[model samples]
Target: MDTQHDNALTHALAAIPGPVPPSGVLHVVIPHTSRFTVVGNHLAQHAELSLIAIGIAVYIQSLPTGTEVGIKALTARFPEGEVKIARALRELEAHGYLRRTRVRLTKGRVATRTVFCNQPGAVLRGAVVGAVPVVGPAVRSTTPAPTLVREHIHVPEPEPVAVPTAVPEEPRPVPEPVPVREAAHPPVRLPLRTAPTQPRRPLPHPRALTPELRQAASALLADLRRHAEELVLSEEAVEELVPGVAAWLERDATTDAIRRALTADLPKPLKHPARLLRHRLTALLPPPLPGIHDLAQPRRTPVTPFQTCDGCERAFRSHDPGHCRDCRAQYWEAA
Candidate 1:
């Protein structure tokens, strides 16, 4: 439930010897397999006390070496609360397991850290030979010397002889001589190859439009206006050839962008409004053929006749027969 408590459980379980006692194996295994309750109890009763000592000792041993532990982290590892943890730590310190360095703030809280005070002494006394650096190579311990034993029981006799003196010989000397040679010349190194530069490309010339082509294009556009109510031209199409039209509209070349507007479905009368306007304007303009606008016109006569009578709401071919049959009957009734 608590961080320290949980850490304690974890630490105790971790500390349990890998090779368990035969008697406790089954119990430990059952607890390990079950919901960890048996493990928790074992930790509470046994493993925890030893581990607390270890934690405090380890913390203290680290302190003199300039190591530190936060109060929060310490509490988290201590299964018991700060009181018990502090007590155990103090006990370890008193027992010379540690040498206090200093207290300091960590994460807005205070904590005590220490180092192993007896480490140097242990190293000096050769009890922990490897603990000291200088004596590492020559610290091989002397094995106990074997004892010699003697047994009594022996006897023997001897014979006599004469001795003689004699002569000596000579010594010799040695000599050395040899020289080495080098080749006639040194070797030369080859150079590396570099990539070559490529030639540059030329730009294209602008095209010029012919007068005849321009006129033909204009006429074609006027014809299109006869059928289209809105001119929804593509940007590519305008950029390709409508320079004259755009110039006529006085749109600035850079800023006044002319985008073709689109139209939704229109009623029959409005569908060809642009066409009607184009026809009227075209007729007013001079044609390439002389008097072509006037010559194209057809003659017409004005009419003055009523095809239906307004008063009777009936059909009549002449104005004189204004009253229909239904009106005549109503007139007779009134008389």
Candidate 2:
């Protein structure tokens, strides 16, 4: 029975796989009493510090000694942006987990060094008591630590010697007062005056029109005013309609012709006069006939003049003189 048991044990040991070979990768050993461990626990239990602040503190503590821990570097390690990383660093500093001091370099330049503390502020203060503060960047060392140089120095007591007594000095007499002379000339005073007000000038009237055309325009406006409830014509609307009425008169259409065309075949209630007028004026106009002189001459295409834009200074083909389309849109927006 013992021999059978030994054979079974040997078979089980043979069936197991061999151990993995070392990859030569170096590893850092974190002791249980390290400041990083203590700070990490404190951060985990902290109620004031946010998750981002806690994570940033842990990342700073885990970095190798003397490593550059700038905002750019922190942003690259984490998914957050530079602003967020900077805010998190500030939060860490507020909680006494980190500090940064500007250090002067040997080459007449300046740099910032970040110091991380794992222990609380009280504990850290006690540890550095009676010792000069560390100035350079913090780094790990294999050699023994150096002794701290104290800031206070002891001085030897002076030898005891005999001294003579001092004498008191006499007081000086006061001088007589002198009167000051007045100025020969005095400043002159100027009288204040009120500004005169000017009367405001009246606005100029629109361009002059012929009596016949003006009478026709007025008759059309009066007809629309009579049906004001349906027309909804304000003073501005009447002014706008005068131009269209003048155009009809130039085509030899009488006021009576326009009134009949605009008011004929109307619905019981004229809900929209503007739409009806626009349609009649556009559709009822007779087709233009060619003039005798125009018919005799050869037809020629009108040439578009090149104009420079006031805003962009670029040349473009246009009949009207002003800014280009893009500049005009921008100007209207500003207005």
lDDT for each residue of candidate 1 in 197-284, tens digit (9 for 90 to 100): 7653221111444564445445544444344545434435433433343232222222112112212233455644444333333332
Q: Please give, for residues 11-89, the per-residue lDDT of candidate 2 as tens digits.
A: 7655546653366533333346333333446567766677887887666555555566788877888899987787777
Top model number, TM-score: 2
Please, what is the TM-score per model? 0.20, 0.30
Clashes of each: 5, 0
- What candidate 1 gets wrong by more than 4 Å, as runs, is 1-51, 58-67, 70-72, 76-79, 102-113, 117-335
- On lDDT, the leading prediction is 2
Q: What is the C-alpha lDDT of each candidate?
A: 0.40, 0.60
Worst 10 residues of 2 by lDDT: 146-155
Model 2 misplaced stretches (Cα beyond 4 Å) = 1-40, 124-335
